[model samples]
Target: MGDNTLALAGGNDKKWSDITSQESTDINTPVSFADTKVKNVIGYDNNTETNVRVATIEDYENLRDATNREFAYGVLYGDGATETMESIEDVYEYYRIENGGRGYPESNRGMRGCFVFNTENGNNLFFPIGATGYGQRRTEHAWYGETQLGAGRLQYAWRNEEYKKKDELGYRPLFLDVYRRPGAIYWVRTIPTNPTNKNKKYCFLDINYFTFDFSPGETEPTLGTGTSACFIRCVEEIP
Candidate 1:
């Protein structure tokens, strides 16, 4: 009758014996369960059969709500390939379904809304700017280019000499893993406060050949062709 105890149903002697012998725990020992509800817990990689302490969509949203920055996650098309705004919306909608179908609202605790970056980030950012989302607009109009670099995400991926713990990166002022291919170029919305060209509206971060390079005056944003995708993981003021 215990939560972790699974009683053998009507099964043959051999199969039941095999399953129970390995999975069964001592009733008297009292197995320790997760502190929170199993469903509430994050970082469960079923494939790996281990908990990966990577940031979930909820983590991204929490970071966004607390700090007004948009934690964009997607593959930006750069190399000659092009996609429209509608396509991006489709991709985002698919992403929502994949990440647990619009998780319980932080305020309501269970109400689900078609929450978008505009709703969380508090800006009508999904407008026609060729492609991309509201983070670009918010970065341009407000925040004034105070976004964190993509390298900021990697800071938590491993335990370095400075950060002995993996979770330690989460405590930093701004932590995000706008994960993408190493060689692919990614977009950074921070418009140069003093750009060489005043007409340029967007800037980009190039992560290729094991080097981090920032390029100003990117009139057009692209994430290459095929599976090469870009992510927009930035930081904002912690509200």
Candidate 2:
């Protein structure tokens, strides 16, 4: 009659002994529960005050696989305000329709390949594979300089001092694909350290046929000069 006890017909109480004999012989044997059991475990959600489906190991594996695929293609999802790595084809279709049906151009399509460079202050930093150039003389100036204005810009953008140092030593990120264009020069955000005329020199990447020339100490051209028309490579942050 107690709440924990189960009563059968004729007011008889049932216990584990009564059900043990009825159970299949295979029940006692140790068998694999890979797919047959624990498919969808239900748990109560305190915040929503409802029952929610709990994620299993399989669910985590699927998510990790999907994320790897997204990272490979640099696919992004979400509205303009927010973005995440999911629903690749849907976002691509939306982007294609929004951009006058032209989608992305071939030369600049490499920009779509983005990978997480690092995480700082709870935000993820991503660097695109391709670079973009500002029109006219604007492209000549390094966005960050050795002057007071550009002093902390590199640290602010990249956040990790060690990675910046590695970058200065021509360290290429493993996630980035080999740039299609060889002998291409691009402007990096890091400012070179020059005791004399600090504002005049800025760090630029002289990408050679097989390797990167990332020496920040070497001087290139003065800022705002028309001769240094280097493509601008940018790093973006996402929360």
Candidate 3:
């Protein structure tokens, strides 16, 4: 089958006629085909479906093996309230399994892991591969703050003590995340700036040290006056 075609027994989408035979089977179970595999691993959701497992290639730049007992945490930022580190790990592992327990997918192709970040100006930032690729680029930290966006494992970002200088900054981050290879341990990039900085980016800043605010207007206002409005652009993934 092609790469897009998920090798599921019943396939990803099953038409009504494919399963509405009205057979007196277990209705509660997701209508999937039974497997005769040797080792059936139970998923967190009590799912018995044999996940398609793929092997992870251990390279100095891509995948790193982890301890079976030890757990890795992540500092999540861009994810909304829904996706957490534990949930991300669950999805990560699920894909690994779907690829035959190998963390690497068989049809590996490089695509920019970018996202669209709208700027105050009439432009857009196509940040391909947000932190994941950035983490892979940096060589400083072994674990970036991307793990907290995992599945529902833990949420420590809301804690005041975890965040540094909370009184001044207004957010508290109490956890760390492994950015991963093809990733980084700690991925810190900078906010885009105008030509005023001469293209020198303000990357890898300690977010705990900055303050953020968004003030909009009909047109850009001046820096210091009653009607004058200024927007200081800053972003942090931690609490």
RMSD of each: 23.1, 26.8, 23.7
CA RMSD (A), model 1? 23.1
What are the per-residue Cα lDDT tens digits for candidate 2 across 146-196? 332221111111111222444544645531323222233445443433456
The C-alpha lDDT values of all candidates are 0.27, 0.30, 0.23
- The alpha-carbon deviation from the true structure for residue 173 of candidate 2, after best TM-score superposition, in angstroms, is 28
Error of 3 at 136 (Å): 4.2
In model 3, where is the ten-residue run with the lowest total lDDT? Answer: 213-222
lDDT of 2 at 149: 24
| lDDT ranking, best first | 2, 1, 3
Best model per lDDT: 2
Question: lDDT: which is higher, 2 or 3?
Answer: 2
Clashing pairs in 2: none
Question: What's model 3's lDDT at 79?
Answer: 25
CA lDDT of 155 in candidate 3? 20
Candidate 2 ranges beyond 4 A from true positions: 1-102, 105-182, 194-202, 210-217, 222-225
Q: What are the clash counts of all predictions, listed in order?
A: 12, 0, 47
Q: Which stretches of candidate 1 lie over 4 Å from their true place?
A: 1-182, 190-194, 210-217, 221-229
Candidate ranking under TM-score, highest first, comes to: 2, 1, 3
